[model samples]
Target: MEASKIRLTVPEGIDPSRVLGAGDGVLRALENLVRAHVVARGDSVAVSGDPDEVELVARFFEHAFREADAGRTLSADDVSRCLAVLRDGEHDASSLRDDVLLSYRGRVIRPKTLGQKRYVDAIRSSTITFGLGPAGTGKTYLAMALAVAALKRHEVGRLILTRPVVEAGENLGFLPGTLEEKIDPYMRPLYDALFDMMDRERTDELMERGVIEIAPLAYMRGRTLSDAFVVLDEAQNTTPEQMKMFLTRLGFNSKFVITGDLSQRDLVGRRGGLADVEKILGRVDDVAFSHLERADVVRHALVGRIVEAYDAYDDVREQRSRDRKESR
Candidate 1:
């Protein structure tokens, strides 16, 4: 079979150098576009192979960067919509627009930040989604939002939230009270997200009704979850075996959102479950993995900066430790 070609028309009045950069620039852009089956660059950018892919890419460039020289600032929403068009193979823009506009529980769930939108879409389409990144990047919050949205739309019967209860090297056995009580602190972030989406009284009511269930990662073993939206928060603390077990527990009619900050793993000397999942299933079809970087963070402005700072700090520490070990 012959490889199809795509001709991309660079708009006039816009500096190709600036837009495409020098050497390898145009190739990189075309590579991204082609991933969506849009176009392949040659003497001139042309769309071949799939007719729908060609038109979609053409429309995306036209709508997104057509007026670049006019000093038009592309908002985050614009970027999100364009990406959604590419990610979803559907030719109809109306459905993408409608999904983007759809509100959950009177709160407009539009993907204002690029990562948030990607995470939401992944959660909706894939049976399993891995949201990995630093803190304050909406990794857990966005997953909770999607889970809540699914529950509200009756796509799932209940919401199950779980996380490893490892904190400050404290063993779960040493903690006072029952299993739930011991794990509540570690799972507080998940609870906080629920409270934000649902009213305090209503959230409590649901908890009492068992419509919303929170548990430690240990309790997730030996069970099959069906007709539920399960979220594993702070998954970076889970060992590789635990992560595998949790993922395989998904029964029929169930979806999972696993969120974690790799740098914050509490399990010393043990690999993070979330990281292991990404490594093992990155290329698996029907599984979506979205990464939230520091830029996509929309919390307090300082939060984004803080995440970046910690990332830099960790990088430096790792490098120094490696150097010292080599020297020894």
Candidate 2:
């Protein structure tokens, strides 16, 4: 057997050190993963070893260079993810890396998973998109990103972020603070996402000018939202009537995103608004439902396993109940 060698010229304007990673850590990681001797020189990377290993290394960096060309700096996590995708052959690196949506303060926001990519696409193409999934799937976060992008592009006049506050487990009037203070906790996630995409000063300015509205879902009643981007988060907490009211509030030239986790609904003793509306309008034109499963979870790796475990438990519990009924 003979050693095969391949070299890749790093693209100009992309720091070769970044492509290879800080202190050549990324090169070492790639070398260890692909069983190859990786070397990086001025504006070029060379791979030598087993022919197959050399080929894998070449293909892996090829994808990495493509990502760099697309305005993405390679991170250690990205290196691992791209390597896995290349090995598994389920999806290409370009699908995971291209299309920079928003970049703020050195943070590049784009879909980190395939489901998120579909959810983003649904928001772009449909008038209403339901981001149905478990926690950590970037459902609400991605919707907020898209809303911010639309606002910046002037595709919409304003941004509306609302969520049902049922999860508080406390009555609103009894809370010690004012209405804004009372609802702040429930709306914090939306605010966090917004601030992540925009500076605090600008976010506050937009909110003060009424260009961005963050309110409890109750406030959406009797108002038509025109030329705005609206995101209804934690939608599983809304009653059917509330959902209907919110849906009807969608005026012309607006985009609406509804995100929820069906398993985590806090609504008491009645069907959740998200589930009800999904059944009723699921077949309607220009409305999309992008369902994300445990595999789409982008949080700490354990979260996906946790979601899968809970789903399996629920399945067994349901089967046991059915068996008990059959015995009767």
Candidate 3:
């Protein structure tokens, strides 16, 4: 057996002594990043077994050397931190694709951002997943994508999408039309995401055939969903009891993805189901939760900034509320 070797191309203006810091410490840290790569040719590093791992090692040295040439001091600990990030795929450009791509309808659907990837993975791996984040972060979109993929793969018999029918500031009873027509506006976001993943005509056909079902959270009670992918979008508006009822409906082989923006809950009362679920089920092992920050917003660039602005406002408002209570 022979030990693997990694060839390093010391670029001009970067002193090798600076990288090593006049000792073997930096060399050892670099060795950990190299793991199993072998020098196949000058300036090229190769590793047997996994191409992904080899590329990871190659990228670390590339970034490390660039920092060294810029007169930035590189300690062994810094090198270790860089390797850790790379190993976690933070620096890998294709990390999002590797995590979220699913082949469906003869096309590949990949999440546009890291938040979307985490949301999809959580839905797949856990019996229940909560995608809590600001608007435009793909929480609803990825959940719909997962539901479509599950149906396409025959892993589930049907797809059920629902949301609370809470009106922001209006009375739903005053709205004309049948129950379904009145509630359609609230469920539009869920429908839009579904339409994007599946052809509109085909989606219409499925809805008519009951293969795909969309309704309000009120309709989910007294039912057990077996072999189904159930997504509750905009769930923050659900009352705590409603949220509990939905979770209990998870039957054999069914997966549930519940997505909401806590700050936007329209439930009026302080006991929204989405918030309660986060507090109660957050510690459960088989349930996964992904909280997306403004950085994970993958919509229009402006949307990310808007999310951040709202977050800052909310933080200030919350602090003021706390201060008022304490003063009393």
Candidate 4:
């Protein structure tokens, strides 16, 4: 079959170079990926390729330009996300607009990819949501945004952010000044996310008043968390007992978002509680498990490729193990 060709017209309001990226990097990626020849000619994109590939290129432009039109500056990461959404078979980019989860101080927090959108939606509708994915997929950040948004809306009385401090799991007294001081390094990410969404004064006030409590997961035992939005970050380091204790702490009118990168689990001798709970809660009601992939990574463009390489390496190792097992 002969390769088809199409000339994509670019509107005057949008710059072709912006969509194409600096040095035509995105263009080169498209050409190499779809095996299509892409070129930017005076306010339009000229491409020759297979019919489906041509259509895909068109959809990518549609998604990218839609985001660009929605007041977001275009980037190579945006281009990659657009292509990811197209590959995921979701064509509409309109929902990516006007859907500000939270807006404060000119910083708008919203899902940048379809996978993130699903994860965010799951957080909204579920009692317990597990955002299991690689790093930089916005799992923890988006969960934090939702928690803050819910707090602002008065849907929850308070917000509780906690993470498993694997380094000082139960031996915090041996470390330093105070309990808070000892775990400060491990819990800084959660505090950083809170400060990003809220002002330091308000956050500090809430902490002083105990409305917004940032504590290590070990402190959660024997407590019923009620009327709050609770987040368990870095849950993959949790043991089964700790996970049960954490889940059982869910009190009335509370929501939980457990975000972790299972691949980065730090448990050396025991299975990660997140891995266990996923299998146990696969069929439970009001529970959601959203998985993000390498393509869902929204950090540096190389991050997604790095995730892909690691995934491929893991696949090879697993296959080799299976082959050895068969021989034995």
**How many clashes (backbone N, Cα, C below 3 Å) per candidate?**
8, 0, 1, 0
Best by lDDT: 2
**Residue-level error in angstroms, candidate 1, position 232:** 0.5
Candidate 2 has an lDDT of 0.84
Q: What local lDDT score does residue 212 receive in model 2, on the 0 to 100 scale?
A: 96
True-structure RMSD, every candidate = 9.7, 4.5, 10.5, 2.8
lDDT tens readout by residue for model 2, 123-242: 899999999999999999888888888888899999999998885578888888888898898888888888888989988998999999999999998999999999999999998899
Error of 3 at 246 (Å): 0.5
What tens digits encode model 1's per-residue C-alpha lDDT throughout 1-328?
Answer: 4544556666666654433335534335554644344433432355565555555666656553443554543443344445455556553332333233233256644454555666777888899998888787777777777777778788888899998878787877899999768777887887777877787887888889988898888888999999999999888888889989999999999998888888786788876777667667989997889988786776777987888887899899999999999999
> Can you tell me which runs of candidate 2 are displaced by over 4 Å?
1-61, 68-92, 98-103
Give the Cα-based TM-score of candidate 1 against the true structure.
0.67
- The TM-scores of all predictions, comma-separated, are 0.67, 0.79, 0.71, 0.87
- Give me the overall lDDT of model 4: 0.83
Computed on alpha carbons, the lDDT of every model, listed in order, comes to: 0.71, 0.84, 0.74, 0.83
Candidate 3: which pairs clash? 5-39
lDDT of 4 by residue, 178-219 (tens): 776877989999988888888889889988998899999999
The positional error of residue 153 in candidate 4, measured at the CA in angstroms, is 1.9
- Per-residue lDDT for 167 in model 2? 50
* Residue 121, model 4: Cα distance from true site in angstroms: 1.6
Off by over 4 Å in 1: 1-107, 169-176, 321-328
Ordering by TM-score? 4, 2, 3, 1
Better of 2 and 4 by lDDT: 2
